[model samples]
Target: MPTPNKPDFQPVLIVAGPTASGKSALALDMANTFDGVVINADSMQVYKELRVLSARPDDGELARAPHRLYGVLSGAEACSAGKWREMAMAEIAECHAKGKLPIITGGTGMYLNALTAGIAPIPDVPMRIRETVTAELAEMGHVAFFDKLKRDDPETAAKLDGNNTQRMIRAAEVFAHTGRGLASWHNEPVLTPPENMFFKKLCYMPPRDILYDRCNRRFDLMIAQGALDEVRDLIALNLPPTAPVMKAVGVRELSSYLSGTTDLETARDLSQRETRRYAKRQLTWFRHQMTDKEIIDTQYSESLADKLRHDINQFLLTTPK
Candidate 1:
């Protein structure tokens, strides 16, 4: 396979879609064809403890192509979008220096948005403020805390799901520390992307029924591949509930089963349902948030690659270098 002609600025290929939509497979194929480096954009896949649950590229897949930013962090550490963007930017630059295309693949919309669209440079809230807000949330409960957030930062509160404790706490902390609503900071001018770099975006939007079925089957495969044991070991670490890894799709459901609070079948059913719902949410996000991408309406396969070959080649070979 021929490498892309050296361009003046980096050209990144982004393969984005809902979970179980085969983004990794497509990215691996593109890497082999274009002498590219496959870089992870998924939040969960970054955690070292979530191999099966995150559907991270298996050993065979990893060996077939160069990959970056996968399984680089411990589950105990929270990977905010800013943190991931910093890491991904380093990987992307390294790929460019090595004369390899950077193919970023994942389902995490926030991480993708941070990379491609830029994000607000909101100042970090003090740890003291974060702890205070968390304590208040614990004391007042989600309902009361959310009501307080509505009064204090209605713009942010209105956009959030009241049940999302982490976001609620974050909103409250931002307001407490800065005396400004989180939404206001978001509306501020954000860190801009590099002026010369270009992105070629591809998004998969498979039929809902087919996508849902795939989600179900994929969860079953996760179980067969030791997702339960993975969760067991993760739980043994006793990471805080607020840790992002603890909120992965199957983690809670499987944890319940591991603790003997639910049967394996019941846990599996709930996990599958949650996975489907998560996929639906992802589809909605990409549909509305990333309207500029080239949308492929089917799940990835060899035929899909064949179909996209000419267009991708045009992008790599014909674009300015």
Candidate 2:
């Protein structure tokens, strides 16, 4: 059932989950039924060269309703969480201007977190500083680098997992560049929507074994759908090694096979394993960060829509404009 449109109200709906968890299907259904616009929140989906590997909406899916932000960026451009949040806010405003509900759907936890909690405006470190920090971390090893971070930016280090080398390096670099802790910058005023705004967030977590099966099946389908050719074209572009899309899930594994470093079987196995591991991390992040939101184990079932409709309707009715 569609929620009755009240004159002053604009809805923001967030559907988040692990990859291959059927988040897109549910978001499409909601967009069709509620006269909503589906907006991309997945970080990788923004890259134009990765349509097949990213599992972006197909022509048929786009024909069902309006979609925004997917495939809007080049592979050479890195889409950070803060940049994505800014783009999303603009999209949400446009949706409201058209009196359409905005439904953000993706598996990227940082993007979702930035939207809901507001992103900290960290200053950019100079290229030299960034390179210096990167080199130091590599030379000293992750353990020593993480220990140094704990000493210099204990507040930021306390919140980060020691194994998250990328973020740990970022925090260390911030301290090195500015002599200010990254966590302290996070305490500054955040850029977010007005105080009256609200978001109805939902997290989909299918059963572990079932979700793993879906991930494997989805990768197989992606291969059949010409993901290898997509990667080949992407590789021909010869983007930098540090390019964000180069690290996209299937890219490395498939590229190895294409380069004759591995067989198709090995590539497929490695991709599937990495995808399952990513899903596991997503599940953990959502479990810890989104404990207050509704958690649904869809198990790739269509039956969840009716309940979703009811929940959305209630949220629309009760949440003030």
Error (Å) of candidate 2 at residue 182 is: 3.2
**Pairs clashing in candidate 2?**
none
For candidate 1, list the clashing residue pairs, or say none. none
- Candidate 1 lDDT, tens digit per residue, 174-260? 899999999999999987678767788999878999999999999999999999999999999987776788999999999999889
Q: What would the per-residue lDDT of candidate 2 be over residues 1-321, giving only the tens digit for each residue?
A: 234455556579998999999889989998988888999999899999999999999999999999999999988676778888889989998988887889999999888888888778876565456667878888999899999999999999999999997898789878998899999998989976666567898888999999999999999999999999999999999876556789999999999999999999999999999999999999999999874688987554556678788889888777774
Task: Give me the candidate number with maximum TM-score.
Answer: 1
- State every prediction's TM-score relative to the real structure: 0.88, 0.85
The superposed Cα distance between candidate 2 and the true structure at residue 144, in angstroms, equals 11
